[model samples]
Target: MLYWWSKFVLLGPLLRLLCRPTIEGVDRIPESGGAILASNHLAVVDSFFLPLLVPRRITFLAKREYFTEPGAIGWAKKQFFTGVGQVPVDRSGGSAAQAAMSTAVRLLREEKLLGIYPEGTRSPDGRLYKGKTGVARMALEAEVPVIPVAMIGTDKVNPIGSRMWRPHHVHIKVGEPLDFSRYEGMAGDRFIERSMTDEIMYSLMELSGQTYVDLYAASVKEKAAAAEREAARSDARDAARVPGTRAG
Candidate 1:
């Protein structure tokens, strides 16, 4: 209810005016049916933008943090998410992620469009990382077609740490529906599962124009964090060398 209300009532007019998204193959998305809208996670705004752009009421798996925020901000965040028809998914990995996948399958069975990010998280360095097999497993088990939608230039509008939105245009490209009919009932095999996931990622790579990374997002994030710390320490040391600057 809230999803439609917000999309058509609240912010629809302004969002449309600001972002005149040029869509290609909009007809590719079925008018009414169950399928997976798998896309590369590029920005936090991807959730809002993609859902709004698509004609269907696409359901995205949102992070648990949005539901766990504090104070008035928390209340508003909850309302906004609920309005957009987002499902709460704990992204911490392990058991929580597994449970989320299970719920996703249930939604698929109901013949609804389920949006998932095969790459797990937003590309840290604007590069498409390896996709997790979870997406493949879901599609095979649910027997649904996967549509690879790529969102580019959104990271610039709302990058990782920047708290302001820049007046830059964002582009979204929707690829043809990728059929996995040959792999029907093959989710049980780990090898086939990985291969299917890779095929989806390759389509997304062409759509989003992001460099492909062989490593996982979590590992790369850890290394990036460590590098930032080292750089910070080096900067502090250099500052201390100046006259009158406090030093250890």
Candidate 2:
């Protein structure tokens, strides 16, 4: 009820009016039963616009920090995310990841639409990154079809570092569902999981028309951050040097 209220009454209407969002092949989404909507992570608004346009409620596994932060702002965030039908899961690796996977499989068993970003993080440069195999494991474990969804122009509407969303046309393209029934009961096999994950990323690359990078998005982000830090350190060293004096 809260999801619908927030979508139709509170946020959905405003988003629709401003962005004038469009979707292609929306009919590809199953009318019933569980299925995974595997999407390319372009921007934060990818979550909002996709659910706003899709008829069924799509639940995403958000980071636990979004719900557990302290202070009044955190409380509001928790309420808003909860109202919008997001489930919080610990993203920390190891046991936490397995627990989150279990939660996702449980949701699928309940016949709910689960939205997953296979890249595990938003694209750092708008290029599709190699997908994490967790998505493959979930689909095989849940025995659900994976539908590739491409969120176009969402980055423009809610670009990185922007506090407010700007007016821009947003489009969602839904591709045919990829069936991995061939790999049924082989969820934990690393080789099979890699193949399945690669296939999903290929579909996303085709749908979104974004350059596909074989490396993980998280790794790319870490490298970029390292480079920035090195640059900053270099600048600091230069500043500390005596003016008009050559270094020994």
Q: What is the TM-score of each candidate against the true structure?
A: 0.90, 0.96
Q: Best candidate per TM-score, number?
A: 2
Candidate 1, 179-207: lDDT as tens digits: 99998878779999899889999999988
Tens-digit lDDT track of model 2 for 51-156: 8999999999999999998999999899888877799999899999999999999999999999999999999889999999999999999999999999999989
Native-referenced Cα lDDT, model 2: 0.93
CA lDDT of 131 in candidate 1?
94
> Model 1 residue 100 lDDT?
86
The runs of at least 3 residues in candidate 1 whose Cα sits more than 4 Å from the true structure, single-residue gaps closed, are: 233-248
In the predicted model 1, the residue pairs found to clash are: none
Q: Considering only N, C-alpha and C atoms within 3 Å, which residue pairs clash in candidate 2?
A: none
How many Å off is the CA of 144 in candidate 2? 0.6
What are the candidates' C-alpha RMSDs? 2.3, 2.2
